[model samples]
Target: MKTEIRFTHQSLVENSKSGDRTAQYQLYELYVDAMYNVSMRFLGVKEDAEDIVQESFVDAFRNLDKFKYESSFGAWLKRIVINKSINHLKVKRLPLAAMDDNEYHLTNEDEHEYQNIDAMDIMKVKSGIEKLPYGYKQIINLYLLEGFDHNEISDVLGITTSTSKSQYHRAKKKLVEIINTL
Candidate 1:
């Protein structure tokens, strides 16, 4: 049963892995838009997102044989897109050394407030996320929207787990403020 779930779009993937043009084209058509959106959420630039999505598809197809189906094809492709987008950001961004490390932990009162926010509007949150600075935006996109835990975000961003945890809390606080004004 686990294998069955992992083998989503198996036939198309297998055919594409074997260099079947039609199968590859079908997979491209099925995933392109979703991949573009994922890239856009991180890159925040239309041209960069489009280029990254295109490169992701190319890399995915080129490395198709290496895909073992441990994850769904879409998930695998999304990872490539995310990695490329993050790398793109890293190239253009600076290190976060200016912030104090002690502010990493959230207090009980902050946690309670964070939990009680009445943010039922997805569009407002999305817009607020878009307005966030690059550092906060990356943390919010990775932790909240992508459902990544601190460990996974740390691994992806090459930061410590504690740093990831702190950054996410800080980013969420900023997001809440932005959402309120929206």
Candidate 2:
């Protein structure tokens, strides 16, 4: 079933690449909301998210020919959107700090301590996330909300893997503190 859906999506993408306006629109309709959500996760501002989504789609269409089938079209498009979002943040001078290797290390024991956060109120957690500093917020959103692992986060943000892991651990701690205060 999943393979069939992917083939259908790929066909639409191929048609769009061939300049079929209806196929392009279909692809847009299929992915706009998800892409919009991805933009919103990186950018809290509605206007910024909307602008990035538009820009991402335009860029995606323009470069459709360069897209190879190594990954799903959605995955390919997501990479484009994420890169655009990060670039937008860079333009705004959002500073993501690099951490020393020895600054923070998470043991399995420490991981167990934070598992209780899963039971916290969703609204409260989201509010806490929004209240975080820009750098911390981005790391948290990429790792926790967007399902990117530390290596992937490092690549996306142009930080080292160690920095990504350190930032994520610190961000999780800070988020807990924020949620506790609320």
Candidate 3:
């Protein structure tokens, strides 16, 4: 017989913790489609994205009790999806550049350069990012766009923290070069 599903946040958590099969399925169904979109943002391949989404849901479910509602369920699920995508890429052994302790700084005057930049200018910069090589693109996306710190990036990409820092520098340089060409 078909069962009814209640979607309240509290109900889902309580039922999920109690091993209610129907509620578990309901939880998965509620988030899978949205999580798949999140997965696809990192993993462009259709099947790979789907696989990441499924793995994320499984992982999320396994740790559901640990979810303290510090963030919404959707946010929690999105993290899992993103983590899965990073792990999937890591398995392919993408040649990650190592970072050094040297801090590369841009000139202060140029630092405020985007002050007058409008939406189109930002879009132009984003378009340039798309042209970067895979390694550069991912580094920029994670370190700059996603605001991940070097240590976090190093762990995610399975590279040294110094490597993460160096790759970020290279990615920024390449991005600026691309934007200048446009």
Q: In model 2, what is the error at residue 147, expressed in angstroms?
A: 1.6
lDDT of 3 by residue, 1-182 (tens): 97665679768877888888777788888888888866665666799999888888788888889998898887788877877887787687655444455655446565465444344387887788777776787777777656679898877777777777677777777777788789
The CA lDDT at 156 in model 1 is: 91
What is the full ranking by lDDT, best candidate first?
2, 1, 3
Candidate 3 segments exceeding 4 Å error: 1-4, 113-118, 121-127, 143-155, 158-166, 179-182
Query: For model 2, how does the per-residue alpha-carbon lDDT over 109-180 read when each residue is reduced to its tens digit?
Result: 989979999999999999999988888988998888878999999899888898898998888999999999
lDDT tens readout by residue for model 1, 1-182 = 34322233899999888898878888998899999999999988899999999999999999998899899999999999998999999898734334665766788888887774554587887888888888888888888778889899889989888888888888888889998898
Better of 2 and 3 by TM-score: 2
Clash tally, candidates in order: 0, 0, 3
Error of 3 at 172 (Å): 3.5
TM-score of 3: 0.72
Worst 10 residues of 3 by lDDT: 111-120
Model 1: CA > 4 A from native? 1-8, 94-100
TM-score winner: 2
Each candidate's TM vs. the true structure?
A: 0.89, 0.90, 0.72
| Maximum-lDDT candidate | 2
Full ranking by TM-score: 2, 1, 3
lDDT of 3: 0.75
Reference-based lDDT, residue 127, model 2:
94
